[model samples]
Each structure stands twice: as C-alpha cells, then as structure tokens.
Target: MAKKVIPLTNTQVKQAKAQDKEYILSDGDGLQLKIKTTGSKTWVFKYSKPFTKKRSNIGFGVYPEVSLAQAREKRKNARELLAQDIDPKTYKDEQQLKQQEIHSNTLQVVAENWFSIKQSSISPNYAKDIWRSMELHIFPSLGKYPVASLTAPVVIAVLKKVAKEGNLETVRRLAQRLNEVMTFAVNTGLIHANSLSGIRAAFEKPAVKHMATIKPEELPELMQTLNASNLQIVTRALIEWQLHTMTRSNESAKAEWSEIDLDKKLWIIPAERMKMKREHVIPLTKQMISILSVLSSFKRPYCPYLFPSNRDPKKHINTETVNKVLRRIGYHNRLVAHGFRALASTTLNEQEFNPDVIEAALAHVDKNTVRKAYNRAEYLKHRTELMTWWSEHIEECAKGSLSVTASVVNAKFG
Candidate 1:
C-alpha cells in the first residue's frame, strides 16, 4: 500500500524550527518546505523525470519571499509539466533561456546591431540622420520591447502617434527603417516574420511637395537679380553653375576638378558620387567651360574641389550654400537650388525637345532595363546639342533678349 500524505499549514510551517541538519516538511502532492540548519527555509518541488523515473528537486524560491500559496501554485505547474512527460527542471531551464533571449534581443538592441552593419555602406551624414530619427522617434516607445513580441498593431500605433505631430515625412522614413530592421531580424532567424511588412498602408500618404521653382519666363529676372547681387563671388559662381548644369545641389557643390575634362568638353561624374549609382557624362557648353575657367583661376593650391569651402579648402562648399544665396536674395519659398532641375525639365519638355535627351541630361534612371543597359549614353549627341542651346538660352535670358518664343530650333550644334 502507498503511504498516506498530509498537507502543511502556514501556522505549522511558521512553528517548525530548523534542526542541526536539513529536513523537509511535506505539504502533499510533491510540495515540500525544506528547512536548513542555517535557519533558512525554501520551497522545493520533488518530482520524477518522466522517462527515466529519476527523482529531482527544483527550488521554487526561498520561503516568505515566496509565500505558501505562491509556492503551491508553482508546485502545481511543475507537477503538470511532469505529467506531460517534460522534466520540471528541464522546463524551468528552458523558460530561463527564453527569458534571457528576450532580454538580449530587444527592439533597440537589434536595431542598433542592424544599424552598425548598415552604417559602413552609407554616407556618414545620412547614417547619422537615420540614427537620430530613431532615437528621437522610435526608441522611446518600442526600444525595450523584445523584437519577437512586437506586432503590427503595436508598431502602427507608435507610428500614428508620430504622424499626429504632423511629421508625416518622418513617419514614412521611420516606417521604412522599422521594416528594414524587422526584415534583418527575420533574415538572421531572430524573428519568425517581419511584423512591419506592408504596415505603410496604415499611414496617410504624405502630400508631395515638389521643390519650389519659378516659371521659365521668370528665369531672366532671376538671372539679372543673381548677376546684380553683391553676394560673395564664390556663392554667386555656385548659383550660376547649379542653374547652368541643372545638377543636384550637393552634386554641384561637391564637384571635383578631376571629374572635369576641359579638352573633352565633358564632366564624367563617377558612379560613387552620383545618386543613381551609375556614371554620368555632362557635355560642357562654351559658357560652362568659361565658368569652369574662372573657378579654376581661384582654385586653392592642392585643393581638388571646384567649389572648395572658404573656411576649409580641403572640404567642398556647404550643400546649402546656393540655397542660402537664393534665400538671401529674397527668393525663399518661391525658389530653391533644386528648382533648377524642375525648371529645365519643364522648359525643355514643353518646347518638345527629345524627352530621352532631356532625361539623359538630367541623369535620371531609365525604367526599361535593356534600354538603360545599352543606351545609358545613347542620346549623347542630342544632349550635346541640347546643352549648347540651353547655355546660349541662359545667356540670352541674362542679357534680357530671351522671349517666351525662344526655342532650341534656331541654335547650331554638331
């Protein structure tokens, strides 16, 4: 016959005194209060391994820290695990490992790790901006959560809060960053799936605000203002180069003398420096060459940039320098440095210039893969003609001889 068991009570447990050696007071169903000679008491669950039938004792916790009722609950849970053929101690170890993993794989920890890998491939300024955005916007609410526990609803809620502040652009960028980090976690086996995938649909689409630009007819007045303004000579030159080339502000500001070929009448912007990750060739007009000639005369010794910073010759001019010039000349909000590209595209397209040639001049990526592969420079001849006409047209505008009827049809090119 099996031995009868008796349950323990709080009063009996409190009255029970420690002996010279360790001893156990049974509370029935494998729950026991263990008393040590050092006057300490612990709650332990005595169970048998399901397959091996080996006895094991797993500590619930020290007594009083773990009340009798709490210890009974833990003992019941461990008994359930043993009945399911899982060793209680092994289950406890597994739970501990899972908790450790949760601690280590938090959203901020994983995001920072992912950022560390990504920072090497992107520009320093761009990387810093990405990290700054996350720190200000994302980390506060979600950083401490385990990445595995993050769900779409939780992420969307956080983003909506950011959107509520009228920072829709930041919301979009942060959503993209979140998706990237989640995808990284998925790829690295830290997550089962990317919870942020397709979450952008939940956000309101931010209104597109094209950079401010002036009408084509406004160019003559703008050019006259630029010419008559008493801004620094270098700033004035930077503005002229931006309008003449229609390059991105940063591209023009960071121009290197080595990229220009006065003999070839071309500027070959390398792939690394270009936004499209493809090399671009700009066919220089005589006016463009003259501007470069003047810039070359002022070039500092051992400096490589065409527009070196006034304070630091080793660095290029600030990317915002030309925009600031426009603002100082009272064109703020009415026009910006990037407006030149839109101005050129609009004017040339309206005049029925070959769209392909204009697009090539802008260095825009062609959507057709085969055409992009074969015809990256296909419209060079036409683009050369277009650039020459464009420069002369700019000169006519500056001289106030240009009318709305002015077109490239009358210009000569080879």
Candidate 2:
C-alpha cells in the first residue's frame, strides 16, 4: 500500500514554531522544513544514492530565505536528476568547484603568477618593462575574465585595437607576452589549452625601422663636429668610448673599472649587463685605452660607472645621453647612439670582414643556434683583429683622414 503524502502550505510553514526538541514538517516528495530548538528553520532534501541506494540529505538552504515553494522546486529538480541516474549532491558539489575555479583563475591572477616565475630569468629593468606593458595594454580590458573563458578571437580583438592606434610594434610585443602568460596558465593547469596561441596572426606585422644613422663618408664630418662642440668632457669621452668599443649606449655608460683588464686588453661585460644575456669580451684597442685614460682622470670616487649621471653619481648616465648629445650637436633625426652599431657594421661589411665575426663582435644572437655556439668559440681572434681595425678607422675619421683606413683595410684584406 502507498503512503499518502501531504504538501506544506505557506500559511502552515510561516506559523510553525520550534519546540523544545527539533522537529520536521513534510512538504511531500522528499522535501522537509526542519525547525531547531534554537528557532532556526531550514529546508532539507532526502534522497537515495543512485548506485549505492544509500540515503542522503542535501540542504536546500535556511528557511524563510528558501520558502516552501522554492524547497518543493529544489526537490523536483533533484528527483529529475535521480531519474537520469545522477546524484544531486555530486552535481551541486561540481558546480560549486567550477564557480570557485572561475573566481580564482582570472587572467590577471594567472598572468601575475606567471610573471613572478618569469622575473627570475630576465633583468630587473626588462622585467619592469614587461609588467608595465601588461598593466597599460592588457589588464584594462580582459583582466577579470577567467583564463578558461579567454578565446583567441577575444585576445586578437584587443590586440587589433592597440594596432589601430598605430602602435603596431607595441601590439606585436603585447601579443608575444600575452601568449607567454597564457602558456604559463596552461602549464599551471589554469586552463586546458592555450587558446590565445594564434592571436598574434590577427594583427599586421610591425615594420622594421632601422635606427637613424649617417653614411660612412660622413664619418669624418661627424667626428669633426663632435670634437668642435663645447660638450662636457665626460660626455664626449663616453661617446668616443662607445664608438670605439662598438657597445650599446647603456653597456658603455654602465662600464665599471673592474671590467677593464689592462693585462688581457679586453673589456669583459658580464652576462647580466649584456643585451643577449651572454658575457661579451671586447678586445680593447690602444685608442679605446686612451679614451679610458681620459675617463680615469675625470672619475669620481663615489661613482662606479664610467659615465655617471650628472645629477646622481651612484647611477649610470641615462641611456638617452648619447642621443641628446647628438641632437644638441646638430645631428638631430640623422643619428642616435645605437646607430653606432649600424655604422660599424656597414663599414666592416664593406671592408670585407667576415659577416660572422662582425655579428659576433656586435654581440648579436645568431639565428642558427648550432652556428652561434661554434662562432662564439672560434671567432675571438678574428673579432679582435676586426675591432682593432675599426678603432683605427675611427681614429682616422677623427683626424679628418678617412682614406687612411681604406688603404689599411685594402692591404689587410688583400
């Protein structure tokens, strides 16, 4: 015989009072309103596990917050799950876990985690630049979105917006960084896969704009202008040192006396200070030594840098120091400090120096990894000869006798 069941009415539920002991009021179909001795009422659903046939109770919520009608509806939903062989409690638990994951695995959260791991492998200044770029470009738009929810199209659209502002290079860099962050997210199990992998293909590739520089024939004129300018002594020496060594502006500016080995006749820049993250050994020429001697006379006791900032002796000169000097000396838009590398490359290539040795001297990363390893080991002697020749060429230009280097290069290569 089937037991008859009566459903709870709103009036009865509202008026029900808690006794000395806790008791329950049936709402039919496994729904019950339980009243505790403390007067707190709650809704509960009693059901049997689909596989084990074990009875279990799931809390719908506290009563008044969940009325009789709502409790009945929850019971009806649970019954449907039982019909489909799904446990209502397991389903609820899975949904709660998914919600927790969504709240915790946001794009910004995952990206920050990834950056923390990435910071150890790169220079502090470079790491700051990367984080600042993300703050400016990425975090504003999609930071709150869960990494699992991010799609390639969504990220590509954001990049395309950056591209529209004529910052194609910024867009390109942002794409690479964003991809790295997303890959980190995948590696850390935040997302199933890297959905943002193809986002870079959405934007136009940035144009390659070489640094502005002067032609080889104009070297003598530039040297003449540099010498005639009433520039500060230290600044002039810094420029000459950078040109002679063919090092980047910051690398030259940040040079320490300890890095210069008089016996070895080499300026050994540590890996941390180099652009390629490898130690660079520049063979010091007699002209390079002469410039160092001038700097030695001007060196402040408190400053470790060859080109200390005028405002702060503890820090090296700003990277823009050479550019500003060039602009002030009437070379605006035509030359920059970094342009010195291009100048050296052009002159050396024209003189028929081996391209591999020239690239090695410039400390450029070779595209062929195997060849790069071989060249680094094999090209030091050749690099020294080439750098010595370049310094002599710079000296001839400074003397306003550019043709002297031509005869030397011809005799050497011949």
The TM-score between candidate 1 and the true structure equals 0.82
lDDT of 1 by residue, 167-192 (tens): 89899899999999999999988888
User: What do the candidate models score in CA lDDT, each in turn?
Assistant: 0.83, 0.84
Q: Write the per-residue lDDT of candidate 2 for residues 101-156, one digit (tens) a residue.
A: 97788989988899989898897888999999999989999899898898888888
Candidate No. with top lDDT: 2
In model 2, the worst 10-residue window by lDDT is 401-410
Model 1 CA RMSD to the hidden true structure, in angstroms: 5.3
TM-score of 2: 0.80
Residue 305 of model 1 has an lDDT of 92
Error of 1 at 270 (Å): 2.4
Q: Per-candidate TM vs. native?
A: 0.82, 0.80
